[model samples]
Target chain A: MTMHPDVAVLARYADGDPGLDEASVWSVESHLETCADCRARLAGQIPDDTRALLDVVGAAVGRGIEAGPAPARRRMAIRRRRLAVTPAPWLTMTAGVLGCAVLLHAIAPDLPSLVLLLAPVAPLPGVAASWNRRTDPAWELVAGTPSAGLGMLLRRTTAVLAVVIPLLALAGARTGAPLAMLLTPCLAFTAASIALGSLIGVRRAAAGLGTVWSVAVVAPSLATAQLPVVLTPGGAAAWAAAAVGMAGFAAARADLFRRLNSAD
Target chain B: MRTISAAETAPATYAWAVHAEQLKVRAGRHLAVDGLDLRLRTGVHGLLGPNGAGKTTLMRALATVLKTAGGELTLLGEPVSGRGDLRRVRRELGYLPQDFGFYPRFTVREFVEYMAWLKEMPKASIPAAAQRAVERVGLTAKADAKMKTLSGGMVRRAGIAQAIVNDPQVLLLDEPTVGLDPEQRLDFRELLADIGVDSCVLVSTHLVEDVVAACTDVVLVNEGKLVFQGSPEALMAHGEQGDPGFSPAERGYSALLRRHRGGAA
Candidate 1:
């Protein structure tokens, strides 16, 4: 037969003393589980007041377990919280607007595929949506948090692109536009907006870049029925360079995002 | 490995939870918190001011939501400068904004738990800490209720739950009792009193009675500058014998604001 715990160890374990090692405490608890005499010894070591509090807490916990919500419902609630990281309203609205533009392309096949021409700027609104304080209801609370800077903004921007990129790809596939023409410029503009966003504001940068693309490329290309030089295969290298340079700029000035106020 | 408690990491023996030296924060072009130097320790201090007097701006700056345009601000002995310092300070901060926005679909408990995660609380401690905060705010029954379904007062309480979930060293609540009913307001004041004993709690409010009941000191601001900082009794002494208001505290509040406004004009 194994030996019982010493009186001193039992007393220290009962008192939850800092010096008591986990192995000794575990041994004492294991012994008490099977040995009635040791259990009695452990109980005697606990003060009456402490025992009374334990009884009260134990009874309350028992009652609570009986009355608590079912585990299934609790799990569902947890699952909902886990899945609650959906895109903001502005992002949803951007997708909706882009969907309408795609519909416009479908109706007018004779006209140039607005989807390909517009691909560069399609994700801009959604990217802006990810960081816009005025539009987000939880902005005040979220802005005050430690992680409420470029890292979080970029994460949300990635989420927006994750959804928007596939949509743009589908639009390009349907319209028979070259993938590089649509994809490279799209990434370049996104990077440009983010880089400039660090200087001004994300919302302002998106709106400004979107307007410039529309005027400089979309309108001219639409007028002549010829693809803009910037969207041509020959231009892919330039687009790639702009994207890399702007991305570097955005990373360098990431700290600016933290000081961006809603009022600004 | 011994798990260190939050108390050990953030010792309470520090001199001031908030220390601002000539802190200048701008809202637009105007300086909202202009050259304001103040020190706050661990206790409930009421911030009394009129509209547009920079109460919200000061709270926002302290919460690290708005950056200081000029001067120095330190939170919990950590200087509020550079990215690393800001992150360290934010880990120990809890703020309830004036608007207190939320996602309508998030359950009350989810909102608090999300805030705990944002404060960088350990993943294992978050669920239990969030639950305790919800219970403390008397929202146990509605823990599963979606935020949109809650009444204004309930949402306010939800906001309160999130602020305290981290057991922050510096807790800032701007107009926290606005939507709450009289009974809820009383309960909220008690919660403030309880937390005020340990942490530095600065509550900005228009309600004079709430401050008189719960605050150890009153800081009156007017036109983006400190008018007075003293005990409630000292503020009460400012009221004239024949001043017309609901209570002596209200009269004192009115008298002081009026006097400050007069002097500023």
Candidate 2:
């Protein structure tokens, strides 16, 4: 008695028969046309081992096709989502600092009258430190991905500045200083401090390093002159631009370092 | 060369479902899993070790949650250390960390659904899949209950439920039956047996009975090295030489005596 073509084909595949060629394929196809049980059996005989291997290859191909634009899109989504949900620690810290500065302005209407003017800059360090600690883990995880680290850093820094710079402006107005003059130095210093703080924290430094550094820069200037000559409009603007540029560079490098480490 | 028959042609596939070579991990200065090589095939494989024996560390490396310091590891034929390999392999992998934490406010269903999402199951299919997993683990009644409201045993069952929610090809359960009572443990063993049909299930615990009842193979890792790998019967046979009074028995009183003597020996 002759076996069904489907059974023969499946037997050939299962029994390590090496002669399966166009004839065997045709025989199996014809057998499947009429035989449901044999077809089902043939389906089961496809070797799950081979199927699993194919699945892995298929999955890899699918991922390769999808991986390119995905990180960029995910990065943007994460940035937007983080911006929406991130607890504005900087805002709270800035508010606390502004409150302290306003209280001091009220208590000591100083000799230069602009002594209360530099109080906003004093809180820059604290705000920078808080932001660094709050955002570092998230930034590190993002950096591990193929996302643009600078893009994410800029988004976070912009979000922080959005909240902090305006509060400093309000403080400047209250201190009887020009909004532009107060804003320039405060923004410049805050931006620079954030860049430095983020870089230091990524290197696993102890917390408050940024605050100490920022204080070192500002404290000496404050003790020497009520409003230093560098606090002038053109000088402050130049410092702010330079600070922003440096922050951009630091954020990019920090991201690159994290990615390289993760890859290794 | 003589050609072998297909049935006799030793399976070209069915290689180690998990293979790790020279796996190294460090926590501060302490080496967690050090230069360990491991291979697991089908059936329930029990990982036996005392606490801090690097069992959990090894499990985490296999689960792809923790990266190894030095190793070439493969899961289901894919290099585990590769960027997207975890996500891909994780689709067919189920892991229950020893100390599982869930969002306290989430319902059991919600938690499992979240896991399904993380496992990359289709969103549309997650609800039914979660329901099936809950039912399989006998948690259908507690499906809507808040995770925090569940008892410790129920929480453990829920964790197992989530791990197997995707019907993974590789199921890694870390102390899966820790908080369960006898009846629940039996029920869990039945569930594991049912799921082990087309998948490789591994449960890590020091409990010998758990291995004896559920696992076809037992692996004992002592101080980050594989000390033994074989069937429970083989392990019992090894121990029998040292203890002449020990004898294997069927269930109930006789089995209890054998276990006691084995322990005392």
Candidate 3:
């Protein structure tokens, strides 16, 4: 019976018999077309050798694969999913501060110091970002999801804004400016703080960066300036314009968080 | 391309515990699983292969933990693409990952119960369900012990207990008996055989006797592709003489020896 060249080639390949090359491979392919028995032999032997070798190796590394629990990918996914659902305790603290903003307005008739209102805004964004750092996996998952990162950040920022803006309006009304007029400095400071915090967090900067930014800018601006005198009609309008500018900056910071987490 | 409208549905009839077609997975530069097709049904199915052969990757895919880069994959007849479908299928699915760990602080019962919760079992039924699984794995006495306190074998038993807690329809155990003693290994094989009656159990291991003893079928994967799939006897018989002969003395019996770790083939 004529042996298939394919089987002969495989045998030669297995034994590492010399003088077999591309031409030999082609010749075997041609022979396999005409011979069935040799083809069967070649088909059977090749896999047998491969499997025998693999069985040996698999036995060796089997122990390591067994002992290592929790692969990195699964851990990351779980982290991200948990973060998306659970808010940090700091968020609750911020909510408490918002509550205080409301209570302070009712209890003391005179407009509370701008320092008190703007003080919370300065650290709030950084604190929120720090909480996010502790739960990086959760943020990474959210960043991976179909939802836009900007949208998620904006949603968070908007939530804070909802609490702060109303309290600021109440304080603004007590300070004798138009409701929209009172929004300028408070909104600017809030936006600037959120923007600065988000930026520092994205750059992997330390938490103190936000505090430093707050001390350097807001502390000085509030101490030397006479707020009631500065709240003339044109000044209020200018403040409103500045607040709108800062909101734009906050939107950009949100975008940066989305990109960083998505890259992960 | 023709746009086909509804009402032309031809439902699938295969009794597959896991069926996947043209599955693909890419991690960084390596293609872990590429253009793979698989069908696992009834009995214990052993997945055998070398390192980086994609056996673990395929198991993870079947568990619905890793998203396929391409292809149609289903677990227990439900498509694994959507979250809702995955959740429904996951209720019947049990997965023991290759490297599985528990919270060190959790007692054995708590760890298993926590897994049951992840499977979305009812709160009231979790305790009974966890108890049943612990009994099945012979870990009932250790149920109160913290995971950190358990030996390696005990930890593996705990992992098996958690996987089978819900009495899953499709169970994927990646190297289930890894750290077990010979007696424990035999007990695990028996446990798997008993559970294989109604559910499809897939065991990925390098051990051939595990397949010979417990599995009704075997699939050998090599380098991201399937090399062979058949019954253990059929695999042994592939190139044998009349009656597909198997001798106790042959190196081929090494397949079984490797599986049982030098035990009786």
Listed per model in order, the count of residue pairs whose N, CA or C atoms clash below 3 Å is: 0, 0, 4
Provide i-RMS per model in Å: 2.5, 7.9, 9.6
The whole-model C-alpha lDDT of candidate 3 against the native structure comes to: 0.63
Write the number of the candidate with greater TM-score, choosing between 1 and 3. Answer: 1
Which has the better lDDT: candidate 1, or candidate 3? 1
- lDDT (Cα, tens digit) per residue for candidate 2, span B1-265: 2233464334535488888888886544678887778888777898876567789878867776555678788888788654442455667788887877665666888778766765667766777888899998999999989888999999999988888887777899888988999999999888878877667888998677777888888777655666667787777655533443234411222333345446546
- Predictions in order: lDDT: 0.83, 0.64, 0.63
Q: Which lDDT tens digits does candidate 1 get at residues B1-265?
A: 2355676556555588899888899988999999888889989999998899999999999998887888888898888844544777787788999987787878998888878877778877888899999998999999999999999999999999999988887999999998899999889988999988778999999988889999998999887888888899988888987776788888888899888889878
What residue pairs clash in candidate 2, if any at all?
none
Give the worst 10-residue stretch by lDDT in candidate 2 chain A.
Answer: A139-148
lDDT string, candidate 2, A1-264, tens digits: 234764566867654467988777666667677878886786677767877886999999999888766543311222244354443564676578677766676776663334234533544433443334244332221222223234444555577667766776677777776666666665655555545544454223223433554476456654764555566556766866766796676655553322223211
Which portions of model 1 miss their true places by more than 4 Å?
A1-112, A262-264, B1-13, B81-85
Record all residue pairs in model 1 with backbone atoms less than 3 Å apart, i.e. clashing: none
- Model 2 residue B246 CA deviation (Å) reads 7.9
lDDT of 1 by residue, A76-165 (tens): 434234322545465567667667767887887776778778889988877877677766677888777787787877777777787778
TM-score of each candidate structure, all chains considered together: 0.83, 0.59, 0.52
> What ranges in model 2 sit over 4 Å off?
A1-209, A212-215, A218-264, B1-14, B82-85, B241-265
- Candidate 3 local lDDT, B41-152, one digit each (tens): 8788888876788988788767766657788887777777433434566677787877764557668887787677657777677778888889888988898898899999
Report how far off residue B262 is in candidate 3 (Å): 29
